[model samples]
Target: MAASPAKKRILVGQSGGPTAAINSSLAGVVAGAREAGAETVGMRYGIQGYLAGRTVALGEALPDDDALALLRRTPSSWLGSCRFKLPALDAPEAEGFFADAFAKLEADGFDAVLYIGGNDSMDTIAKLGAWGARMGSPIRFIGVPKTIDDDLVGIDHTPGYGSAARFVATAVSEVARDADVYDLKSVTFVEIMGRDAGWLAGSACLAGPDLVLLPEVTLDEDALIERISVLLEHQNTVVVAMSEGVRGADGHLIAEKTVAAGTGVDEFGHLAQLSGPSRYLAGVAKARLGVKTRAVELSTLQRCASHCASEVDLDEAFELGRRGVSAALAGESVRMCTLTRTGDEPYAAEYGTVDVLEVANKVKPVPREWICADGMGVTDDFRRYVAPLAGTLPQQLKGL
Candidate 1:
């Protein structure tokens, strides 16, 4: 009797930053691969570790249903992560790097390599897929999108965004109430993450922040101060949700002063230090408006708050992971799994694939029409588009 085809083997890795639902995707990959009668291996720290021969067998690391269930709710990258950028397919350095990486994959009989990450990570998949094609290799490369930034193109929204949006909305809502409790005039500035896109900062609209500042709209410092001064006159507390990436009319980051001295850019050339936007705004508000000012930077908490994760986000994230395995098994390559929004009435989404090359190194900015004419708030259309994915916030008690 002819021997059955050998079990398919695939390697997976996580890269870029971690998110609350990133592991849910990892769990789905592991569970799906096992159920498909395939062997699964994980990179300890994404491609960086894989290049160094650091890997773990998923069958041994996660043995059963219980492990996967727990992983779905686990916050952060389960297999560690990295931000290593790969050399261009045509670059001289690429000759050796690709040769070594492909040699390793071929030696281990890997049918595919799946990467879970954001824009930068997708770029890696694009390069690998291109290299494999050039060398006539059979191994496939796939990207399962994950990012709180929600900046990736070709997808309705990314997996980690919903959970992070949930956290931002919940935290801002709670903080708004706390800021108002003292019966004193105050301005609370909340700084949220978003380097080139303001999707995360725009989420603050779900919590009813008085003002929302986004990177898409340049900040007019004088106008902002005047607005806050006006807001303080009418309310006990004025809460503003600001994106750390917001820039001035001169096209420079308002939080530039906060960047640590001598901290260079990353492999992707993104600034390494991104904080203090809220503090700078708060100080300005306090000095100009003469009101109590408080600055709160959500920092890493937004991406790591598993307890605040949205069920919609986690479910979709996991399914996308499984989809990656199926795609690889089907001989698909250089593709990134995507979520297409099918309906808005009750909120629905369907999984699909887009060329990784189309998605890599791309940023999807919040639509201009979604922002208010004054650029201080989001429109009803924006709310409708994001509300379902982020889930509903709990009703809070109102003090009479």
Candidate 2:
């Protein structure tokens, strides 16, 4: 569809999880909107907040380049984020929420909506675009990728992943260095964020970890223990990296054992699978293996450590945001701007659009071939792929 003759007023929001480069995307969207001669408004806390009648004009909020520049470097979502999953459209009761969503757009005079988020966020864009089309509304919807999970399909990697992966790698390497300083043998378990994909967890290999557990591979307690035991004989310290979503032989989240009712779920029906893997494994190692253990959960630190944010990730995230605005202005709907890897050495990325439905709510787990045959670590092939993505920064930990 070609853009209409009339100028558009755009509404932008952030949804699902937060990331270090999320703000960079926001800056791009705002700048792109201004450059395209469109008025841009922001949902205070994403669409969920907008439905409650909360919003602000972006031009007034970020009136100058100085403010926009600050936002581009800021970590986390400046517009706030929500995981409020829009119910399936077929549900009769959902009509009211849908009605309100449409009302919000009409009331605010928004002709285009650009949503910055991850997999579930794309689902929201797909739904809203479909709803608008069915209602004969000309409102355009575009999704800008943002996630540390890096599970979204139709792209080489979602924005916010490279920087997070860098942080995780740095944390693993630094934590390992700290653990080894003690004379007594010990095992330090570090848990990273990944619901089902192991990209973040797998990056630990760059830091020289003894083992890397990805959600794509089940957590084999026996094998993990055996490997640690063998390593302890010669090494004073062993560091094991695992994804938070790694499951045990029984097929339950390793975090499940640490909680009575299972890690309570969030708005997306995802396990709030917090630091359980590290704590549980550390507990087990001490009780069964008779070795000192410490569980280190990098948790939010990995996502908010902007000091280590990858320049490559920030640049791509900003460009993706800008591309989303351009796509919507071109009258595109139900489409997402994606990053296609063009080169590895030069680390080039090109923006393209894809049908939102095709990639919505999809999970692209770390490839099995990328995992070592033993399933305890990543293969050399994985290193070759990720090495260039994480920018050149001193990987050295400042303290400890």
Candidate 3:
């Protein structure tokens, strides 16, 4: 009798930042590969770890449904992550690196390799896929999207964004209620995570912040101070949700303008620090308006709050992971899985694929139309766009 087809082997890695739903996507890949009678291996800490020869047999590690269920609920990258940037395919440094990587991948008999990450990670996939094509390698390379920024191009929204957005909205709402307790004129600036785009900060509008500052719109410093002054004239407390990357019309990050020295950049060239914007804005308000001002930087809390995770987000993340694996197994390469929004009322999404080259190193910013004319708030259309992904938030009690 003819022997059955040999089991296809796949290698997957998580890179860049961690999110509440990133592990769920990893679990989905494992489940999908197992169902197809394939072997699934995970890089211990992305491509860098693989080069260091570290990997885990995921199927053997989590052999049952219960383990996968736990993995889905777990926040952060299950396989660890890194920010190691790869050299360009034609760069002098890439020759040895690409040769060694492809040799190792082929030596281990991986039929396909996948990366789960955001923009920078997609860049890795694009480079690897291009290199593989040039060398006529058989192993396919694919990208699975994961980011709290919600700035990945070619997808309606990313998996981690839903959970992060929900957390931001809930946290902002709670903070707003707390700020209202005393009858003192106060302004609280809640800084959220979002570098090039303002999706996360804009999400604070779901909780009805008095103002939402986004990087997409240049900061009018005088106007912001005046707006807060006017807001305090009518109310005892004013809450503003601002993106950490908010910049001035001069096209420089407000955080950089706040501090004298530089913090340096990451391997991917993004600012190593985007935390000072809210504090700077708060200090400015306190000094100028003479009101009680406080800055609250959500920091890392926004990305991995599994308790506030949106069901829709987790479900979509898992489904996308599965679809990505299927696409790679079907001989597709240099592609990233995408989600096309089909319906808004019931909130339906369809899984698809987009060329990884098209998505890599690109940022999808919040649409100008979504921001209010004054650039201080989001429109109802923005709410309609994000509310579904964020799912239902808790209703809080208001005291008179």
Clashes of each: 0, 0, 0
- lDDT tens string, model 3, 258-319? 65475788999987877889889998999999999999999999999999999999999998
Candidate 2: minimum summed lDDT over ten consecutive residues — where? 391-400
- lDDT score of residue 25 within candidate 2: 96
Quote each prediction's TM-score.
0.98, 0.95, 0.98
* Candidate 1 to truth, TM: 0.98
Where does model 2 exceed 4 Å of error?
A: 1-6, 260-263, 395-400
Candidate 3: segments with Cα more than 4 A from true spot: 259-262, 397-400
- For model 2, what is the alpha-carbon lDDT of residue 101? 80
| lDDT: the better of candidates 2 and 3 | 3
For candidate 1, write residues 24-55 as lDDT tens digits.
Answer: 99998998898799999999999999989999
Q: How high is the CA lDDT of each candidate model?
A: 0.92, 0.87, 0.93
Candidate 3 global TM-score: 0.98
Worst 10-residue lDDT window, candidate 1: 391-400
Best by the lDDT measure: 3
